[model samples]
Target chain A: MTIRTTLSAGLAAMSLTATLGASTALADPVTVGLITTLSGGGAGLGVDIRDGFQLALSMSGSDAIHLVVEDDAQRPEQAVQIADRMIQSERAQILTGIVWSNLAMAVVPSATAQDVIYVSPNAGPSQLAGAGCTPNYFNAAYQNDTMHEASGAYANVLGYENTFIMAPNYPAGIDALTGFKRYFEGSLAGELFTQLGQTDFAAEIAQIRASGADSIFIFEPGGMGISFMRQYAQSGIDLPIISAAFSFSQDVLPAVGDSALGVINTAEWSPDMDNAANQAFVAGFQEAYGRLPSVYAAQAFDSANLILSALAAADINDLPAFRTAMRAADFDSVRGAFRFGNNQHPIQNYYAREVVSVDGVLTNRMVGTAFEDHQDVYATDCAME
Target chain B: MTAALFLEQVLNGLQLGLMLFLMSAGLTLVFGVMGLINLAHGSLYMIGAFFCAAAAAASGNFWLGLIAGTAAAAAAGALIEVTVLRRLYDRDHLDQVLATFALILVLSELTKIGFGPFPLFLDVPPILSGTVNLGIAHYPLYRLALIGFGLAVALGLWLLIARTRLGIRIRAGENDREMIAALGVNIRALYTLVFALGAGLAGLAGALVGAVQSVQVGMGEPVLILAFVVIVIGGIGSIKGAMVGALMVGVIDTMGRFLLPRLFGHFMEQSQAAGIGAALASMLIYVLMAAVLVIRPKGLFPAHA
Candidate 1:
């Protein structure tokens, strides 16, 4: 009787454990945790990267990345919470997608500490581009200061005497101002750093109106840009409102409508760039979402391109090689040329652009070159020997 | 600065104040009556704006879309109250916060799934497209109309609460829900009505502001927080207080942003003055809020049933 009972217990244990584990292990897909600001003011950018990443993944015909999505809600604490769950509980092998620098900073350190690789589709903060740069961290987008520095250089070429500089007050805002000052050596009529995500700019506009500046350079992106531009136009300030890449996002232009026309911005790429890559990307994006792709979307696409190349180079079956290959910056980006700076930040050209209304469709088109081989200034200060 | 410039800035303040009133009213009322701190309130505002834009573009009539947007928000508010919020009413505030926070996630993703994450604009009607003269100041006619419309709403809400049986029930509920329920009132129905009313107000606010601003996802959130700040300063659960608080907050925020830096310029460098003043001005509302909290924890004009 004892022998028979032991045999039954052994059979039951096998039934409950070994066979089940074998089947489950081979069937479940490798999950990638895509953390983003899927809600709040940053939702537009989150969705852009979402669509672009999804499209690029589909085009690659690889089932290697099974996304376990979490919306950070544009909160730093929530992003860390989501990252913890994704890493330990959801068992997401790789992490990607963050639109804001503050949030990326919150999540990346945690992910890196766990020895998990994080791929940033956008938001390469200078600190990340410099000293805090990690081997496990690779960014597929432009560094935060690169484009703004380019804008400042172009404003210098335009030869404006009295210029005004404005940015949302934060680390990135300060970075933008620092970057702008690196290239723009002219006298600043006034420097106004306002609160982040401020919807109304009446007070700031009042300040600008009184500054008596010849040119106005600003770094308010997404919905904030629309609010500022609309209010600026209505105030009849009559100065050129310059911007970083964000003023011309697919998220902002529609809000301003005709008010956005003639606004000059600076970026590496625009939908109306008239390049083969730009035209193709714009066409594909419009066909899918029925709207032009913003710079964020373009970066997302570039991220996918880089990721795919890295995956192929590493031979996905080998995770170590995949990490090694990603460290190498495998593919050429959509922006004509790109190379990883010593700190792994991107070195790329920047273009000055204008929003034009052609046949009722409004988008930014490249008007002039701003800076070439433009490196973020803080890279020189980085002690990443 | 010239008087004309100052006059123009004042006009801009009024425009901003009116927009704040639209958002703050519903929020103040929701807090006052329902006694629930809802973070997802902004998501409902976004839903209204999105529906207004889509419907207006489809039907080619802005007015009809505005109506639909109101109804849709009412329906959504009722639905959320019934399905999710009802369960949370008796729970801890933290539970309600967490659950509603989750609701924001659901609503935002659903919006992306439905509207595909693109920002849209609602056009000002042709009749109100141009600027109108106001004491040597040119104002956008649409903006003026918004102020008129907000005043009408304030008046309408006043009459609805003061002159109607529903208002009595709401007041009664705010005073003592158990008493109202024991007195044979259909408390569930009353809650539904209040929730729907608050939601409709929020929707109307979103749609109205949609004309001047972009109708985009999550657009309602920043304004929603400010509205809470408004009610807190004015006194919770009082419509009159909401109106007063909103206008006060708006006017102070606008005027301080404009005037404070100049005031500082007398002693400091122009750039230093602007910087110091701008930083201080941003905090002025919070400072006012803290002072209010010190004086009246319940609010400035606490509602007595």
Candidate 2:
């Protein structure tokens, strides 16, 4: 995997200087512009995405592809600027590698409007799944609410009578709580929304201790997750924490350590998941990156493979053929048995994962399937042709 | 809220304040003595955390890691002062700001290279890992220790500034750099020492806090912002002001988060209340800062006055 990545890096470097007309000699080389949060708070997720995407490209040994990567810095305006540059200057036919829902909302509309194929590896905002869905856009990841919704259902399965749900006060956070409440059969003991990038959780912890909630479902991802889990553990509150995989995946669990042990999270993929595509992606990612692949990496690997399969079927310059090929979703996904809904979002299974101490290191292992072949509820609202 | 819960919240506020104090002390001192707006102060805090996490993991001893982290940060601070900052002592604040901001980017990237993009865990030492019975609420022993340690540092700092020769020199240097230099004090050495001292405080705070939070890249920027607020509210050059400002900011922030939602819940739906409450809670500190600015433009405890 490392050797392949190195070779791809060499190819990518060579392509940087390679003129537009140079690649047209054989066939029109597809330029994929990947704009994601490569710096700031949630950089780990973006890094994983890029690595996963590159790994798949390298493994496929595709020469008819040119990858252009840029950092969005987790800002909407910056993402817009990058999207414009990629579309107008880089002549990228397909745009991917958006990590956050808000940034995706900002860039996807404009990119798809201009006839660029927007394939999302992550950040499946509900709007895109519903009324905002476009024929030019395909979400290789699950909808924004799917994981949280599944976790809420799993909480019911665990017989939780009263659960406290908390998330940051952003669009994603609102979606998280709304999703959790949709399938959560239990009475909500409390609903809390914290400041984005908030590092302290003492006040919230104190409140949760008093609220008498049987379970806590928190959607604080990345650094926020690390702080909350550590503080929650320090607070000596032992309530079961059911979470979305954004906070509990391999990217975050190492930092969360023992505090996150025994916690359950819901996601579309895990490293230890049993499947051929998943096994290859996980092993390849580990060998390349020397770390366990998070679900972000798994989804990104799938996205790249989707692109490859689509490219194999049709030329990127031919919009109708490319769209049809992409719609077919011929790629073998790490999540297994994947297909796109009418809305172009994934119809995939969500799994329950438990954070356990494996060989003295914190990692998530698949516990059970939460929702089988779960198609997002918002897909019905999409009127895309 | 129950008395125990309130007490715990207050303690949490103090713990937060003390952590801010550690960060602000270095920044305030640097500004007061050198008239430099060093934005890279947060990078030093991050350096401490990464060092602490790495050392702790390598040594399997938290104490050794803490010492190493603090010392490394101080050394790095001293090195930067000698190499880069000494040249900027005579430059304007804007130049200092730009240079320091660049330093922040460099340090953050370098730290990311040394440590991977992922966060590192710093476990709470076994002795500080349990809970203490506070009658109505059980508080974490680790947090209590953090507050206690911060207080000790504050007292020690007060003594160092008020009682020690170096402290007197620092204060004197703050008052009149030319006079101190004319009086035979090596201004360059004093500046280096003070810079190193400030870095050590920031580093110590980072090491302590890293146990409670994940040690990751860009961890220091938020704390650095709060520390700036601390110094601004406290009066930039004053240690007493930093302490007061930190406590005030900490309590207000914490209590706002805890009480605001409940306050809004009386008038609206829970979800709406949560959304509005959280929005207001985040803005509470800045509102306090604005109010304070309106009342006293120079801050509550001006070091000079």
Candidate 3:
């Protein structure tokens, strides 16, 4: 299995670098390493992110950048090792493409400490936005709590009095609930946390049926969400559910089928958004990949554009100029207007999306904006000193 | 907390145990009869789920899909037994492990190629979709039916292995493989039959559970791990042990997650209770397995002994 994955990754890297190797007019090639989970439970997320970034790379048509992609297998230790290899052997000046927060936490701090610019396409852990922020680190995506906080705000809008909030028993899960509580005005009937990647939610379903909660907010991601939604629907629990986009996105909607209908989730981007950049991206992505892009894809595409624009603005030898150009956010983001906050995270809008049948398939449709021109609350904690 | 809730939980435990039993029974049978460690068993489970989901979508009949799924898994198992597994029979357990592990990768990749890298949906049949009022609490009719079906299969398996001539041959074969061969029994054919039967059971479990879980690649590995634990606790190579061990693991796991937090809540803050309780609940099964191993290293029912 390891050999097959390594061989495929090597082939992909070779093909990409071979194309860029032709543009040898530049003095020193700017190498970028993408370390993301690509072989395990949530591999779909990484695959989408990689595809989106690669789409951007091909579109940029620049021969100056050399891309090296590797799978971290969703392990923190593995991510750290990949980051080290990317820095030491690959000599990559820019790093991106981590899908999980735990992996980001392990890779970002250490990689940035060594002067490599870490552009996160997904997974904006709270620490990276707060006191632990660094000048070398930039989150082109929304903060980790953006969706959960938006869910909380939307739950208040929907007037759910007594809510039950549940998440996996991990740091990200705690951050999710904390963000939800920050805006939710209603009383919580119960709070629960299950094991990460738990396939069965039978006991948890029983508790939800009995909790008397008017609604539920769940943050189980990837396969965990699929299992929870299926079992929850099977258990005949019809309580209204609000959730983060991590669980209810387009990538997971098909697997869940009718079980996810009427469920609402929060996200920073949707494929149906109206804008020139977004329209081009959606059409190009669909034409190239034959599938609608997820929010993860959109964020990754934007991260790639941000890097490309920075590269266009400054030469590789000038570090200060490159950082300044990146901060300018001069690229046309798929999500209309975009800017970086003091903490290097995006200041963008969060939308409340309901799972609706689009073209005979389950997908999310934007209903309303939860946070317009939203920025992470932790931006104040970042000093950049 | 209430008797009704406890009853519902018990029913849920039974459903889970039965599912595990379906997977473990086949695993133990294959191990006992062949002495070959087959990690690709989970791949068979995945195949069953994928076939069931595809057939259900194509035919729009869940029952037909279930049959097709089980039959396909059996066919696949028999094919592997004849072509690949037969070679590993004489090899050491380590060789068997490596070869079977490689098979898992091959099967999973092939499934991904055939089905695409997306999860397929399988709906519960209409007849079992609704709820049943179990005196104090309402439960899903499908879950209740699943429990009944699993128990029936267990009984049928017991009868097949205990009453029939094939059962006698199987028992004798487990005791002494060479003696059975010298007695003019077609040991090769028997091994293939046993392996196919086991694969079919695993497939049935996958098809049954697919309705309640997303049918996707690698979905079988977690259930496979739990089934291993069940066999170890029940005493490996013993059908009855698999049943008992599955139920014990199921009930303990369910009750632990449901009750541990409440138990802790009585003495501490709710948040603290929830955190610590969930942590302990996740480890409860491993703790039970350790206790079982300490008491009976051969498991609760060693078929050979």
Candidate 4:
């Protein structure tokens, strides 16, 4: 995989320089560096993002953008190193496709400080969304807390008075619980900070059973979520669960299987959203990849289109004009009515989605609107010069 | 905590301990008999899970998948023992570590190539799906089944070591490898058999636990770390120590996670207590290991003594 990525990147760079030599002024080729987790535990998310981004580029049939993809393997140091190499050696103007927040935190600030355009397909850490927000940074995805906040709001709508909340002990986990509490006007029956990557949840389940909570709000992403959901189902507690879509995303739904059926999750987009852009995206992704695209993929697809939109409106050589074009977000987002807030993070609708079997495949369907036209709270803190 | 909740946590601890025993038993045995440190033991566990999940998905029967998983792991164990580990047996600890570590990487990548990047689904069988009333607390039947299976395996292992000719030979081999080989025993074949047995046990644990957890490429590494701690606390190369240490580690870890936060909740805010408690709970097992080592340098039940 590494070899193929390097070879493809080399080919793209060669073609880019060849095109530059041929034409002096019109349609300058822009280089995009995609640094994501392509190996280890978190590979599924990165694979989806890469495939989604590639699919969008292909569907547009535009050769003006040359993408150089590298695997960070979910390591913060590796992401930082890749960002440096892409910036200094590869001369990649736009950097994108980091999956985890820790990696994003490591790479984004420095990348943007170097005057490189940093477009986030996912992993919108609160630091970047607030006081640290830079003019060179644009997040095509919702801020990290948006889905958790949406879950909190949806829980209120469902009339849950007491909810047991649990998250892994990490920066993002803290953010998740804090995000939920910001919008949730209810009593917390129990709050748990489980070990990150700790698979067993028997003790936690026992506590939940004894806590007498009306509902559960969990923020365990990836394998942790898969383990928790399966064990929780077998525990037979019968408490309704509310969570962000990270746990119920299409990348993991098959592994989670029937355990996630009918569970309510909140996200910016679902495969079943009733929009022309979303329908086309879902259909196009299925045709291209032979599977359903997760929220990560939707974000990456939007990120690619956002770049494409900017490229069409302005030249990359003019940094100021290109930055303005990106801020305008003049593209049809997979999630309808997408636009950038003051922080350059998306201000969009958050929807409640339910896991349902579609033709024997486990996927999410749109249930209801959790929050309409929701802008992140951190936008006010962002003072982009 | 209520008495029922405490009892449930105890049961959870026992279940976790037994799974660790299954993993550590094999690891300790290989270390005792051959003096070979096999870091790729976790790879065998991962292989077992992948095989089990794939077989279960293909055959549509959990039992068949379990059997296939165990057998596949045993075969892979034997193959590796013959091809790669045979060379490292005569090398020093560092060489063995390096070789086995490489084996882990190779095995993980191969599994990924075979199974793809996504985690596989492996559910509990219908017979063991729901919760069972345990007089005080309702516990998941599948977990109870796992505890029972662990106990059964432990009993079977004890009986094999104490009562069988192979067991006698194994004990003798552990005492003196040269003497056993001089006494007309095929030591190479015996080594292969023991390695396969250990691999099979690890694989069994992997298949059992994979039903509840995510069955992915690196699932075994975390458990492998705990298993190492179990063996260290129990005494290296001692199955008896593995059992006692596993139980102690399991119970203390679970209870710490269950009680520590609440203990702090008396003086501090709930969320602060939870964060501090969880941080402490994660380190509880290691602290226990260190304490055990200070008190009993040879572990609770050293094989040689």
Candidate 5:
């Protein structure tokens, strides 16, 4: 990933020098401008996306494809700055990668406005799935809230009547909360919205203890989820925690330990998934990276696969045909199957999963398929004709 | 709301406040004495969490992990103070900020390299894991323990500052540096020890928090920012200030997040209420800090001698 980033950085640096200090600038490669939070706490996902994309490129025999990767450093406005340079200056036709919904929102509109194709690897903002959906914007991932909504349905089926929801105060949080409520026929005893990236959830958990919330549905991802889950388990409530997919993914499974054992999560990807593409992707990813692939990797792989198949079927150099072919490609997804929605987001299945023992080792696996091609609630607002 | 529900929320808020105090007291002390704004203090907190998780996992004992995690932070802090920060005492805040920011990158990456990018979990001891019925509501025993633990640290800090030679030296350092150095205090060692002590406090907070949370790279930063806010409101370098600031911030934050949306709901749509309430709740601490700054400039409990 660093190699690709450095190579992109090298290209960008060269182009920058040429733009400022030359007339002999001739060798400008296909610059794929990438923006994501590559620093701060969320850097975990950012690094994974960066490395996953680079690995795909490497496996496909390309690095000088000129990826002008820039770190938002987890800052939203900074992402805009990087996007601007990538478009006007780097002459990038395609923009790829964003880890945060806020950052994605910042970069995607700008990319689409310039008629540039933006391939989103991480954040699938509900706005993009609905009224804000655009032909120029393509999500290589599931909408943010679909996975949690799936969890909610499973929990509802399991007979959890009172569920409490907590999430960071951000657009993605709202999406996840909405999703949970959609399928979770239970009464929300209370919903706690916190600052994005908040470390402590003790106060909220304590409040929940008294709320008589039979089940807790939380959507905190990354380090925050780890803290909340461990604490929740430590709280000795014994309430089943139906979680959004990101909360207990590969990135955090080990961190949360045995406490994460019964954590039923909902997501589109899991290593133990019963599918040929997924099996292949998991094995290959582990072999290549020396660790199991998280959902982010699967999402990136599918995105690249879609891109490859689209480029192959249509005139690779023709932008309009490429976009049309991609929209119609119905590419082989690792998540069994999915199709692009009219809004350029995916109408895909979400799964109900639990961390179960695989050969005496614990890891999350799919228990049941929950929501089928679940559309975002905000899709109604997405005014794309 | 029922009395139990309200009582539970208050306890929850205090637990949150104590956790904040654990981080902010050290931060405020460091700021008061050194005038260095460390953006990477969170990294040290993360270190403690990672260490505690690893130690507890390796030892199968939560207490040992807690101690080891605290020690690990102290050692790391001492090392950083000696190797990196010692050179920066003469530099400006921008330089200090940049250097510490870079340290965050190095430390987070280093943690990733060491621990592998998977999140690590620490288990609460069985005895501490159960919940207690507080007359009206069931609350986690561990959270109550955290509040107790935080109080112990606060009292311990107060006693140390008021009754010990080292504490007096630290107080002296906060007031005058050259005079203290002239008085034959090993100012260098004092700084290292103080930094390490502060780091240890941050680490203890990390380890304590780790039992409830996932331990991963860059886990300490959000708490670190809030810690800064705590100290800023409490007055830099004052332990009492940190306590008051932490409690105020935690209670306000907790209540605002819980009640503000409902309050706003009375005047607006549900979604709009939630959005406005959540945003306001998160920003409320900062708003409070700004207000205090406007009135007092030096914060509520200024550390000035």
Candidate 6:
């Protein structure tokens, strides 16, 4: 009776191992946690990122990846809490989709420390790219300063000498101005640091007028940009404005109305980019969400495809192999020709796009290239162990 | 700064002050008459902007949108007074605060659901689209119109409060609610009327500002904080105090933002000075409020005293 029982137990164990081996041969499931701002002033950006990522995921038709999403409401503390819950309870091995730089600063360090992979779709604060860089972290978006640097480079191209510059007083805001000044060859007419979340720009506009600047370079994003553009238009101080795409992106151009027309802005991706991958992304995104995708959405789509490409090559359980796959970044990016630098941030092209009315719908068209194969200045500072 | 620049800054200050008065007037009136701290005043302001944007898009007339917004806010005020605020009159301030805070959440979510998460476009009317020659500076005609509208509303409010029979009952209720009830006056209806009137004024301010600023969710709370400061400085429940306090706060805030950075620039690098100046300027209004509170604990124009 004992010999018969041992033989039956061995048979059952063999069947269980066979089933596990077959499953491994087929595909290994990956859980991804997406924490983004979904219910506040910044909700528009988050919604675009979420819809873009979901569109990429659904198009891939790979049931191997499971996604869990939560709203951070644009708060750092809330983002931290969500990251904790996703890591511990949901067991999300991969995390992505943070919109604001401040919130990313709060969540990314500890998350990477816990051995979880964080592929940033947006919000690449300079700290993560420099000495604080981690091995497991990858930035699918440009560093925070890179877009602003593009504007600075384009400003030189446009011969904007004695330009008046303004930004809100915060870490990212400071980075924006610093980045612009790094590449700008001309002297500044005026530099003003306005209060964050300031809606009224009348005082600043008056200062700009009195500054005798030839052009204006502002970095006010979201609704602040809408307010500034409207007020600036009414003030009749049209000195040819240039800014990063954060202010002039598709998500905000509609609210900005005719005032945004002909404005030159710098970005890594535009809807009018002439590439098969980009055209497909723009068409698929609009058909799926009924609105043009912003640069944030394009970045998020790339981040998801990046993950999928890595997953297809290596199992998530094999951490070293998966990291190597992600580093390779073997995927067709909507922005075209995307790859990671030594710091794991994207080294790509930045273009200057002009806001134009396309069939009465406001969108951007590529006008010029700002930077070719641009890498972040801080890449040399990253001592990745 | 040049004289033209200074004049432009002053006009900017006046415009900001007048808008604050419109917001503070309603807040003060409700507090004085009902003895209820209505924290949801900002939510009403948001509702006004949303309704105005929607109505303006449908009608293509800013005037129609303005009327629709004002009426909607008044109606919302009346409904809220009858349903939720009536029971809270005798309750503690904490309970009133909690309930009204909840209303903010509910109203904000409902607005988001109705308007989606994006800001709506609302441009200045054609007649008020260009700049006006103000001798020293060319100012936006819509802003000058806003100043004129705000002043007209102030005058109208003063006449209504000082001359009308309804105003007499409102003053009486503020002094002695029990006495007004004993004098065969319908206190419940008066409360609703005052609340609705206050709400209408707030709505008007919101609709006007929405054309200049982005018409989006959570726009009201920042303005609401400044309104509270204005009332506290002017003395709660006093419309005259609200007017004086609003103007002072607005001018100080605008001037602080304009001058503080330049002041620091004389001693420090321009960029460093500008940063420090802006940091201090944001604190200027709160500093002014604290100073006022220290000197006049009851406020500049306390209704009771």
Best by TM-score: 6
RMSD of 1: 4.8
Candidate 6 CAPRI-style tier: medium
> Native contacts recovered, in order, as a fraction for each?
0.45, 0.76, 0.56, 0.75, 0.65, 0.66
Top of the candidates by lDDT? 4
What is the TM-score of chain A, computed separately for every candidate? Answer: 0.89, 0.93, 0.92, 0.93, 0.87, 0.94
- Candidate 2 wrong stretches, greater than 4 Å: A1-28
Which is better, 2 or 4, measured by lDDT? 4
lDDT of 1 at B253: 82
Question: Which one wins on DockQ?
Answer: 4
TM-score between candidate 4 and the true structure: 0.95
lDDT by candidate, in order shown:
0.78, 0.90, 0.89, 0.93, 0.80, 0.92
The residue-by-residue lDDT of candidate 1 on B43-71, one tens digit each, is: 77888888888888889888988998888
Model 4 sits at a Cα RMSD from the real structure of 5.6
Ranking by TM-score: 6, 4, 2, 3, 5, 1
Candidate 1 vs 3: which has more DockQ: 3
Per-residue CA lDDT of model 6 for A16-93, tens digit only, reads 999998787456577899999888678889998999899899988887788999999899999999999999998899
DockQ of each: 0.37, 0.74, 0.59, 0.84, 0.51, 0.76
Alpha-carbon TM-score of each model against the true structure: 0.85, 0.95, 0.93, 0.95, 0.86, 0.96
Q: Write the per-residue lDDT of candidate 5 for residues A215-236, one digit (tens) a residue.
A: 8888887877877777776665
Cα lDDT tens digits, model 3, A255-286, are 89888999989998877788989988988888
* Residue lDDT tens for model 4, B116-191: 9889999999999999998988999999999999999999999998899999988988999999999999999999
